[model samples]
Target: MQWFLLGVALLISGYFIYGKIIERIFGTRPERQTPAFTNNDGVDYVPMSTRKVYLVQLLNIAGLGPIFGPILGALYGPTALLWIVFGSIFAGAVHDYFSGMLSVRAGGASVPTVVGRELGTAAKHFMNSFAVLLLLLVGVVFTLGPAKLLGNLSGTSVPVWVAVIFGYYLIATLVPIDKIIGRLYPLFGALLVFMSVGLLIGLAVSDKSFYAAGITLENLHPQDLPLWPLLFITIACGALSGFHATQSPLMARCMENESNGRFVFYGAMIGEGVIALIWATLGMSFYDSPEALNATLAQGGPAAVVNDVATSLLGGIGGILAILGVVVLPITSGDTSFRAARLILSDFLKFDQKPITKRLMIALPLFAVGFAISLMDFNVIWRYFGWANQMTAVIMLWAAAAWLKRHGKFHWVCTVPATFMTGVVNAYLFSAEIGFGLPLSVAGPIGLASSSVMLVWLLMRGRREQDDLDTPAIAAEQA
Candidate 1:
C-alpha cells in the first residue's frame, strides 16, 4: 500500500512538473508588462531556456524543507504518507506554480513586490520582514538541526559548532546560483540517491524479520495526542507554507521559459512530497513502539533512528551510510537557503547590481544570525517555522485567487487550489487550538490573522468589481 501510494505521488508530480500546470496558466505567448520597471540586464536579468530554468528552479525549491518536514511527519505512522502524497499534487504544487507565474507576469517581481502592489507597501514590508524572520528561524533550527544529527550519526570527532561553521562557510562560497546549480546540485543529488538506494538494500537484507521485530504497529500512540493535529503535522508539506512563496519568487526571477513554471515549481513540490512519503513509510516499517522511536530519537537524534534502521537491515555499514545521507541532505537545503536569503536581501534593499560583492555583505550577516540561532534551542525555532510557513501560504493563495478572478479564469484554474489551501490552513489553525493545546502560539495566531485579512481583501475586491460594473451600466444608460 505504501509503495503504491508513493508511486502515485511520483506520477502526478512528474506530469504537473513536466508541463501540465504551466501550459494551462501561461498558454505560450507572453503577457503584457507593466510600465513601472523596464530595464533589463543580461547578468541578473538574462532570459533563460525552459529546460535550464526548470532544472534550476527544481534544485532551488527542492531543498531540506521537504526532507526534514516529512521525517517529522513520519512519526505519526503510514497515514501521514497518504496526506503528503495527495496534498502535494493538489495543494502544494498549485500554490507554487501559480505563485511563480504571477511573479513572472509582474516583470520578475518577488512575492513581496507582488503583495506590495496589491496590498500596499506596508503589507509588502511586513511580508518581507515576516519571511526573513521565518528564514532565520529555519536556518537556525530546522536547517542546522539536520547537520547536528548527522554529526552524531557519523561518529565524527568534529564538534557541533565546528560542523555548523564549516557548513555556513560552504554555503557562503556557493552564493552564486549558477555555481550551485551547475556544480553542487548534481553532486548533492547523486549522494542522496546513493544513500537512499543503499538504505533500501540494507533493509531488504536485514535478518531481524520485517513483521517480526521491526514492523509491528504496536503502541503507536505515545502522547495520547488526537489524530487530527497529528495528521495536520503529518501532512504539513502538502498544505500551505510561507516558505514556498518565498522560494517561488526566487525561482521566478530567473525563469527561462515562462511556460515551464508548472514543471519547475509544481514538479519540485511533488518531488518533496514523494520523498516525505518514503520517509514516513520508513518510520512505520522500522519501529514497533512509538515510545521506543521517540526515546531513540531523543537519545541519539534522528540519525540514530536512521542508523538503527539501516543496521537492522545492512549491519554496521548501514550506520555509516545513514550518517552520510543525513549530512548531505542539510547541505542541499543550506545552499538553497543561502541563495534564497541573498535574493531576498537584494530585492528588499535595492542593492546595486554591480560588484556582486555587495550582495555577499548582506548575506554574511544573515548567515551569522542563522548560525547563532542554530546554537540555541532548535525545537522552538522549528515550531515557529511551521506557523510562519502556513501564514505565508495563506497570503499567497488569496493573492492567486484574486489574480485568477481578474483574468476571468478563476472558476477553472484558481478556485479549487485556493479553497483547498484555505481549508487546510483553517484546519491547522483549529488543530493548534484544540489538538496541540497551544491556544496562544504564534502559528495559530498568525494563521488566524492572515486568513482574516485574506477574507476581507477577497470580499472588498469583489465588491469593488460589482460597483465598477454598476457604474458602467448607469453611465451607458444616461448617455
Candidate 2:
C-alpha cells in the first residue's frame, strides 16, 4: 500500500511540477525556431521531437546521484523517501524545467551563460569555472563510485584499475555526445527496464515481508539538529543542485517543442526521484543496523547490498539478474556523466569547435582523471558530489525566483520550497561552526561556499534591478 501511494505521489508530482508549471512558463517557445545567436553544428544544437528529447533528458538527468541520495536518506529512515519524492516533484522539477526553458529562449545558452547575461561577464566566467571544477568532482564521485559498486556486484575480478580503465574506454567509445548517445541511449534505457522488471519480480516472489526492513516512526533519531536542515540533506535532489543546472540547459538545446520543457525536465526529475525512493527502500529492508550497513558498505560495498537484497528476494537466478541490473545502473549513469563532461568542455571552452583530434585529446585526460578517482575511495568522493549537486540547485532556485518575480506571478507559485531550501542549506553550513554538530567535510564546505557566493550575487542583482525601477524617468520637457 505504501508503495502504491509512493507511485501515485510520483505521478502527481511529476505532472504538477513539470507538466503544469514548466510547460505553462516555457511551452510557448517551441513554435519559434532556434534563435540566430545559437548556430552550432554539434549535438548540443541538434533539435529533436519532444518525446526523444524527453527520453534523453530523462536518462541523462536521472544519474547515480538519485541512486545514492536516497540510500543516504534512508539512513534517517523510511520516511526520508517521502521527502525525496515530494521535493523532487515540487522543488527539483520546477528548478530544472524553468532553467532549461530559460536557457533555450536565450539562445541555447547554459546556466553560466544565463548568469553572465543577468549578472556580469565576470560573474559568468566565475560560475563557468566553478561549474567546470564541480563537474570534474562530480565525474569522479558519481561516475567512479557507481563503477566500483558495479564491479563488486559483477564479481568479474576486474581490479579497480582495470574496471576504471575499461569504463572510461567504454564511455569514450559508446557515449560521445557527437555520435554515440543518440544511438546508444535507447539501448541503455532498454537494459534499465529489463533489470528493473527482473528485480521487481524477484523481490515480489521471494519476499513476503514488505515493510520488515523499514525504519518505523518510533525509531526516528532524536538529534538536536533542526528538522529543516536534515530535510535539506534527505531531500537534496531538486532544491539546489549544481549538477542539474549544468545538464538542464544542455538538454534544453535539443528540445523539439519548447513547450515540452515541463515534461522533459520535470517528468525526468520525478523519474529519478522514484529511482531514489526504490533504492532507499531496498536498503532499509535489507540492512537494519547502522553499523552493519556501514560494515557491509565497507566490505561488500553498497552495490553488494543491492545484490544481497535481490538475492534475498529472488534466489540464485534473481541474484544474477539483480547483479546485471546493478551493473547497468552505473553504466547508464556514467554514460550520462560522460556526455555532461563533454558538453561542459565544449560549451565553456569552445572545445567542440576544435578539430576532432584536439577534442579527443581533451576528453582522454578527463577520462583518465575519473578513472583514477574510481580506483580510490568512492565514498568520500560521493559526499562531495552531493554537496556540489545541492549547491548548483541552490543557484538555479534563486534564478527561478528571479524569473517568477520578473514575470509578475510570484504570488501564485510555491516559492516557499525554494526559500526553505536556501535557508536550510545555509544552516547546514552554519551547523559546522561552533563545533556543536556534524560538519560536512571539505567538499561540503566547497559546495557551501559556491552556493553562498551565487546566492549573494543573485540577491544583489535583484536589489539593483528594483532600485533602477524606483528611479524617476527623465522628462523631455527640459529640452
Top candidate when judged by TM-score against the true structure: 2
Candidate 1 residue pairs in backbone clash: 17-263, 48-256, 242-389
lDDT of each: 0.58, 0.59
- The local distance difference test score of model 2 is 0.59
> What TM-scores do the predictions have?
0.79, 0.80
Q: Candidate 1 residues 1-479, lDDT tens each?
A: 33635455565755555347545654543443321123244334545555665555555554455556655555655555556765676667777877777666666666776666556668788877877776666555545555565656555543564566446544543344454454555665666666666666654554322222333333244665544434554345543355777767656666655556666777777666655655565665566646666777777655566666656665676566655655565555455555566656677777654465786688678877776776665656666667667667766766676665555553234455554455445556555643354443444555456546655556556422321112233223223
What TM-score quantifies how close candidate 2 is to the native fold?
A: 0.80
| lDDT digits (tens) for residues 94-172 of candidate 2 | 7777677767766666677665554457867777766766666766655555555555656655466356645654455
Model 1: residues >4 Å from true position, as ranges? 1-56, 153-175, 201-220, 238-240, 314-319, 411-460, 463-479
Q: Ten-residue segment with the worst summed lDDT in candidate 2?
A: 470-479
**Predicted model with the maximum lDDT:** 2
